[model samples]
Target: MRNNIAEMEFLYSQESIATQFSRDKFHQFLQEDMIFPLKGVRKKYSKNEIIIPEGEVTNEIYFIESGNVAATKDGENVINFYAENEIIGLTNLLLDSHSEYAFQVISNELFVTKYDKESIIEKVINTQEGYFYHYVHMQNQVSQMIEKEQLLRLPSEQRISLALLILGTKFGEETNDQDLIGFPKSISKGMIGQYTNLNPNTITNVLQKLQEEEIIYPARRAFYVDIFKLEIKLDQVLKK
Candidate 1:
C-alpha cells in the first residue's frame, strides 16, 4: 500500500512539472517567437469595485489577467461581462471619445494588467503583432455586439443559459464528473437578472427547472451547468 501511494505521488509530481513547463514554454513563445511582449502595470481589484466610471475620459487600456468584469451602460444594468485574457477600455484609449459604459469588477480576485495608451501606441501598437492584436480585438467586439442583439430576442431562459455558457466558455474549468463547469466565482442572481433583463423570481424559476432536469447544479450563488445538456435544451426551446 505504501509503495502504491508513493508511485501515485510521483506521478502527480511529474504531471505538475510537465504542466508548468508547458505553460512557461507557451509564454516564452508568445514573447520571443510571436514578438508579443505583454508589458503593463498589474492591478488587483475587489468584487463590485468600479474600474472605469461611465463618461470618464481615460487613456489607459486594461488586459484582464483573471476574474470577471461587468460593463454597464446604466449603473444597474450589465451590458457585457469580460473575463480572462480579454481587453477593455480600448475605445476611449484609441479614440478621443469618452466611455459610454461603466466597468466594474464582478469577481473577487480581479487581476488586471493596465497600460498607458500613449506608451502602448508608441511602443507596442506600432509593431506588427500589436496591429494584429488590435484588429482581432475590434473584430471580437463587433461579433459580441451582434451576439448581444441576438440575445435580446431570445427567451429569458434561453438567454440565461446562453449567458452562462458564454461565461463558462470564457472562464470556467472542465470537470470529469458529468462534464460540469461554470464561472470560477459565484455570480449573484440579481446580477444575472440585470444582465438578462429578467426578474429575480423568473430567474429563480428557470434555475429550478434547469436543476430539476439535471441540466445544472448549484454551487453557492453560481450554477455548474452541463454544457451538452444545456445546449440540447436550448435547441429544443428554440425549435418550439
Candidate 2:
C-alpha cells in the first residue's frame, strides 16, 4: 500500500520542496495576484462530521486532498463526494447557484486547501482558469442534482426506488455473501425530500412500503435497499 500522510510527513523535512502546480500560471496567479496563502491549515474531520452545511451564507471553499465525503440533510445520503481535487463551496452567492446540500466527512480526512470569501473574489478577478474551473464544477454538480430531482418526480414508491438505483450505481458495495448496498454515511430524510419532491413523511411511507414488499430492510437507522429489484421497478416504471 502507498505510504499514508503521517508516515510520509515524518519521512520528509518540514521545509522540503512543495509539490509543483500542474500549470505554473495557476501557481503564479495564486502566489502574486491572489490573496490566499501558499498553504492554509489542513483541517481534519472525523467520520459523520459536518464539514459544511447547505444554504449557509459563506464563501469558504475547500479542495479535497484525501478521504471521501457525503452530502445530505435531516438523514438520507444523496451525493457521494469525491476527492481528486474536487471543490466545495465555489458556487455563486446571491444568485440561485448556491449550494443545496451539506457536506460531511465519511472518515478521518486531511483537507488540504481553502479560500474564504474575499480571497475567492480576488482570485476570480485575477485568474480566469481559477474562476472557470470552479464554475464548471459548480455547474456540473447542479446539473447532475437537477437531473436527479427530475428523475425522482415519480410517485413516492418509484422515487424511492430511483434513489436506490442511484446509490447502487455510484456507491454500492457487496458484503457478507450478498450484493449489499451500503451508505458511506447517513443522509437526512429532509434532504432526500429536497431531491425527491416527496416530503419526509412521504419518503418514510415509501420506505415502509418497500420494506413490506421485501425490497429493503432497516438496520438501526440506515436502510439496506435491494438495488437490483429497485432497478427492475425503475426500468419498468420510468419507461411509462
Best by lDDT: 1
Q: Candidate 1, 168: how far from true, in Å?
A: 2.5
Report the number of the highest-TM-score candidate.
Answer: 1
Instruction: Count steric clashes of candidate 2.
Output: 7
The TM-scores of all predictions, comma-separated, are 0.78, 0.57
Q: What is each predicted model's overall lDDT from 0 to 1?
A: 0.72, 0.59
Tens-digit lDDT string for candidate 2 (35-114) = 65444456777777777777655566676766667766554645544553556665563323446777877645545466
Off by over 4 Å in 2: 1-37, 45-57, 64-86, 93-113, 117-132, 167-179
Off by over 4 Å in 1: 1-39, 92-96, 123-125
Question: Which digits, one per residue and each the tens of the lDDT, describe model 1 over residues 1-240?
Answer: 344335434555644534433322322323453354555688999988999999988888787878889999878888888887777876444645588899998777799878777765653444543443444445468878998788878988889888777767667777786468865564678878888888999889988988999988887756687988878887888889
Provide the clash count, candidate 1: 0
Query: Model 1: which ten-residue window has the lowest total lDDT?
Result: 21-30
